[model samples]
Target: MLHCPRKTARTLVYSGIFLATGLAQAFALDPTGDWRVADGVANIRVAECNGSMWGAVAWEKQPGGRDTHNPDVSKQNRPTLGMPILIDMRKKPGVDQWEGQVYNAKDGQFYSSTIKPLSPDQMEIQGCVLGFLCGGETWTRVAGPIPSSPANSMAKGPPKSPGAPPHTAGMTAPKTTGSVGPKTPGQKLATAAHPADPVGDICLLPDIAGFAH
Candidate 1:
């Protein structure tokens, strides 16, 4: 069979590009898991929402916290436990970063955020507002099964407090909330020994009526 050299070269180039794109997609970092944040005082569950990614406060050191600092007067009364703090993160093409907005309940402000996975068990999370000033934390993956239901989580109650008894089934705790600041020198990111697992429905949060845009 007669063959054209120029056509063969073009075909080879196209094949290479196709393979490269496929490889990038195949090895993309999957951030669908529970991550320990705020110096291990809080656990935020990252999951897929509406083709994008979002994170919600799955568990806090203190339960029954409210979004007292939220700028919106009405939303201030909302509980922070299930609040969607990491909002609408879209994966950046050909990279291990995701760009989105991060809402800080402590300051009641939304900042531009980017999440980059440094390893399967660790990721760098950054939030910036003034363009130049940026703060970040290295979040480590949390292992084991996350509470499957609100009832189950409440049953387990907040992490044990010295001299405090476990909360009753129906009783709620006092609200206590704090801000997540930049990691300081010598600050260690929390780590877990269990293997990473898909968050599944355990971390899914209710859809915010108008949050997605």
Candidate 2:
């Protein structure tokens, strides 16, 4: 009968995992790339910097060519381009979302932000002011590389397709005006836009809409 040492078995198991994880990480698709913020106010480009990954804001789409948010701060004399806005938060098991922080160039404020991977090409960024004081907005993915300059972005024309038909908002269809029909999905249940399941309240229906509720 042949007997393997306990320590040797443990070492072999851990070594296998370590090697597999190292290979996985090496081949993992990195999200570090060019991304444009909502409204094109900021264009962020991520690349390897200082032996670590960092992002730099290449161009800012200034409406009036002025930084009204932080006028005192040197818009030009900044140490880094985009600055250290977001940090790698976590990569939890069974979860695909990547958590991070978002630094507001306006008041120099940092907020808890998250980048949810919608698909291979699309991601949603949720950023707020503080403790729900300010509302959060979603950012859609833009095609191609982030514009180098505001002029270049403008020259490309509107963000939407040029030949696309004009959008008509707030146009509602004629109501039947007869009887109150059955409630649809939206009316049937409520869901939290941003939910933090601490205790794990697994409800059948989406009853709680707000985080607190």
Give me candidate 1's TM-score against the actual structure.
0.59
Residue-level lDDT for 109 in candidate 2: 65
Could you report the Cα RMSD, in angstroms, for every candidate shown? Answer: 12.5, 19.6
User: What total of clashing residue pairs does each candidate reach?
Assistant: 0, 2
Per-residue C-alpha lDDT of model 2 across residues 163-209, encoded as one tens digit per residue:
11122245321110101112234313211321321111111011111
Which regions of candidate 2 deviate over 4 angstroms? 1-30, 47-54, 62-80, 129-131, 140-213
- The C-alpha TM-scores of every prediction are 0.59, 0.40
Tens-place lDDT digits, model 1, residues 84-203: 878888889878788999998879999999998777567789999967689999987763222212222222235322221223344343221111212222122322321232222322
**Steric clash pairs (candidate 2):** 56-82, 57-82
Error of 2 at 40 (Å): 2.0
**For model 1, the run of ten residues with the poorest summed lDDT:** 174-183
Query: Cα lDDT of all candidates, in order?
Result: 0.60, 0.39
